[model samples]
Target: MIPAINIDAALAALTDHWSPKVVARVNDQYVKVAKLKGEFVWHRHDDEDELFQVVRGRLRLQFEDGGETVLEPGELCVIPRGVMHRPVAEEECAILLVETVTTKHTGDVETPRSRSIAEQLA
Candidate 1:
């Protein structure tokens, strides 16, 4: 039987930045939550689109083309596949991520901040 998942509680369980926790799976996608504060690496997924939904505070998605989008609570934006993006949070922020099950945390770029699927599910 599937149990109810609490976004807040799952978010509270996360203690790292840029590390996303897999909370649920729907079809071919994974639902994840993360806490952001500072800047993430600029990377792009060659085969999948990613969605970021702000749960609290704010987030800024910067693109390689110098374009940027600021997201407030309840706001969401989809970063098209293969587009380079760097996520930034001036202050502490909580967010939900929706992406394909095979999507990497930092796209094709690997940093110290990257977390594996096993780690996220654990």
Candidate 2:
């Protein structure tokens, strides 16, 4: 049986800015939290969808066609696989990510800014 966990407590343990400290896991998927700012690399996942939620501050997702959506705190969006999108933050923003085990944070756009960690906890 899996033990209960306090996500708020786990979120507090993270200190490194922009790094997603794994908070928990749901089966083969990982739940992570991170602080983001400025423009991020454009990328796409060929297999799995990417879930993004703005827990605080504001975030914008830019698509290849130049379309975008701004997500304020409490808003969430899921970018389907193979869709090119870039995450942008006007200021320090807290975000929650739900992704599969093998999903790369930046997907196909490999970059130095990708959040690193083997997997998260539950």
Q: Count the backbone clashes (under 3 Å) in each candidate.
A: 0, 1
lDDT for model 1, please: 0.94
Where does candidate 1 clash, by residue pair?
none
What lDDT tens digits, residue by residue, belong to model 2 across residues 1-69?
Answer: 978767667666766555786677789888888888888888899999988998888999999998999
Q: In terms of TM-score, which candidate is strongest?
A: 1
The C-alpha local distance difference test score for the whole of candidate 2 amounts to 0.81
Tens digit of per-residue lDDT, candidate 1, span 79-103 = 9999999999999999999999999
Weakest lDDT window of 10 consecutive positions for candidate 1: 113-122
